[model samples]
Target: MKTEEVLQHVTTPLVNPAFAPVVPRFTDREYLNIVYRTDEAALRAVVPEPLEIEEPLVRFEVMKMGDVSGYGPYTESGQAIPVTFDGERGEYLHAMYLDNFPATASGREVSAYPKTIGSPSLFADNGALVGTLDYGSQRVATATMGYKHHVLDLAEAAAQITVPTFMLKFVPGYDGAPRVAELVRTEITDVVVKQAWAGPARLQLFEHVLAPLADLPVREIVSASHILTDLTLAPVKPVHDYLKGVRS
Candidate 1:
């Protein structure tokens, strides 16, 4: 499908404002954060068997423009280490993309999340890693990875999510080896907090958001990442696991 057509088709109901707004830490940040950590794990039961865990270590930030509630971005920064999935070990690299950049210290893109701090690897190796640490601009994250953190209200639908999503997925090979595939993701949008005691400010996801990906034609949210030769992050030196792949 044409890129413009796809985008237009999906953004019919979705709207955005000019300014990048911040999620109110008072109104919902703390409460939502608690519920998410507690409820997020339950989603695994719904995913297919082969997919393993659906939610990785990801951060979702929310923002507002005009009257529209959902207008923001997601910067996925994490790594996939060698793991025995279905009794096999492989690695995976993960990242996320949307129309807008999350409201951050400077409205940075997901790709530029690592620069927020001095961290390196986003995904830590629970056991074995595919390659090693990346100290080069062309580092394809053979082992670990990292991205940015977005603040979300933690309600049902906080930040509307969409595709053209980029991910570096590693999987176990036939002979207990590792293979990589770019897995796409389903588009998602944020919904308002279910509780009324909360505030009037709420993001209505699924119903108000565009893209139908719950039941029908499943969405394959992935985009192959390419290394840019001209751009260099500078100071490509290997750092410790804890030191890399994390943001404040």
Candidate 2:
């Protein structure tokens, strides 16, 4: 194929391409987020400088997506730390574990999402909403919450979506060297909150060689929330281009 023809190919072309498309819209997404108070020093060690942490907090989420536009159904769970970029409150994604391979590739390349392959699940059983993550046969994290014990205000729950989400975009060079690195920020807007809930919950993190959730070491379970919503994942914007600054 000619160089000009290669530039016009989309969907990754099943071979080699610069980037791929990941425009997925989720419906009836079962989301459970657990906020925990972690050690300030530990949080600081992971979160890069220039992003301040008003409170030493981290949020872990497990989501079961019903129908993804191109990709079929899949489950994902990950952790993020609350931070402030340029005085704006947001969450920086520390790690993401997913089950689908296509979504993983598109997420990391297109949006620079810190995605990795793992076995994660979200379900409701015995009047409780449960989420679990496992690397191989070893369980890494488990979260359980009272099923819709208390109804949450839709507006209040939706407000959280307005906060920008941040992640690192790092592309290594061909020789395994660092090629591109940047801080990317994205937002989820026009959220239609079908239902929301809040109640007492518990989270447990275990140590595993591959998927290590216990590294963060949750000091206390601050709060937990269950939000059922339909939302669109918008395009991301690079707030800090590390390569540009270095090249200059």
Candidate 3:
């Protein structure tokens, strides 16, 4: 490829990219989210600077992708910590583990999503909604909620899902030095909340050295939501550059 063609390339593997360039639109995307309180000191240790923690809260989420524009379907589970950026409340994405490679690749490379490969699933078992995450053969986290016991207001559910999300993007150079370090932000837009509900819920995080989700250690189950929606993820934009003043 010519130099001009290389400059125009959107992602790596110039000839054949891992994922398409089109922004993915999720149809019938399902989410099982449990917000709980955790250790304050532990939250401080994980949450980076420039972001302030409002409460010792963590949202454990398990998402089932019914259909995506370019990547088809996949399951993802992770945690986000409630924080404030520039006095605005938001959630900082701490960890994400999914089952698809293309989605994983694009999430980490094309955008600043903290995505990795793992086995995560969400389904209805009997009268309960079950979400679980497994690293290799060991279980990391499990969350169970009453399957749509009480109706949740559509506006409230939409606001919960559309909150600003922050993520840290870090890349190392070939010389094993810091190449890119920045805080990126994004939010879901054009949301159509098809269904939403709230019910009793419980969460358990097992001690896993690899996944380390248990590090947060759920203290109390604050609330739980089961939301189904069709939405599009807004493009990520860098909000804070960690190495801005240091770089020459």
Candidate 4:
């Protein structure tokens, strides 16, 4: 193929040379987020330096994307740890497991989202919003929240969604060392929360070698929320590039 032909192809070049739009807007999404207090030491251990952990908090969410623009329907479950950077508080994406590969590839390449292939699901059970994650034959995490228990303040929730989120992007070098090491940040925009609810919830993370969610043991279930929203994810930008000694 000629140079121009190769450059025109979409989703091919593992890492794009220049910024090209890769939009995957979600229209209908059902979300369940469970916040829990975790081991203080574990919370501190994974949080990178300069990113402070004010609360021993970890949030596990299971979302079902109904109508995605580029990608089809898929489910995702993951954990985010509450952290602060340079006095700005936000959540740092720790790990994410999804059922779709296309979304997985784009998320990693575009946003540095730590997405891996796994069986994560979201459904209703006994009138509660249920989220589960399974790795092969082992079930690693399960969360259940009371469905639409209390009306949530949409304005407050929208503000929360606008907060900057962080992720660690690492592209290995030829020798298996990190070629690109960066702390990336991204925001969710054009968010319209059609409905929201809050209620009690429960979470359990089983021990598994592949999905070691139990590494951060759940100490207490703080709260849970079920939300329906339409939103777009903004392109990710690097907040810190370790190799280049850049920080912002």
| lDDT by residue for model 2 (47-142), tens | 986788999889999989888777788999999898999988899999999999888878887787899999999989999999999988889999
Global CA lDDT computed for model 4: 0.85
TM-score of 2: 0.93
lDDT accuracy of residue 214 in candidate 4: 93
Q: Which is the winner by TM-score between candidate 2 and candidate 3? A: 3
lDDT for position 201 in model 4: 94
lDDT of 4 by residue, 1-248 (tens): 77897776656653643323458788878888888999999888888876888889998989899888777889998899888887888889999999887888878876799999999898888888889999987899999888788999988667655678999988897988788998988889889999888998999999998888899999999988888899999888888778775422
lDDT of 3 by residue, 60-120 (tens): 9999997999999999999999999999889999999999988999999888999988999
Winner on TM-score between 2 and 4 is 2
Tens-digit lDDT track for model 1 on 119-201? 12322244311222122232322221111122223332332121112222333569765433323222222323422112111
Estimate candidate 1's alpha-carbon lDDT, on a 0 to 1 scale: 0.24
lDDT of each: 0.24, 0.86, 0.95, 0.85
Poorest 10 consecutive residues by lDDT, candidate 4: 13-22
Which is the leading candidate under lDDT? 3
Question: What's the alpha carbon RMSD for model 3?
Answer: 1.1
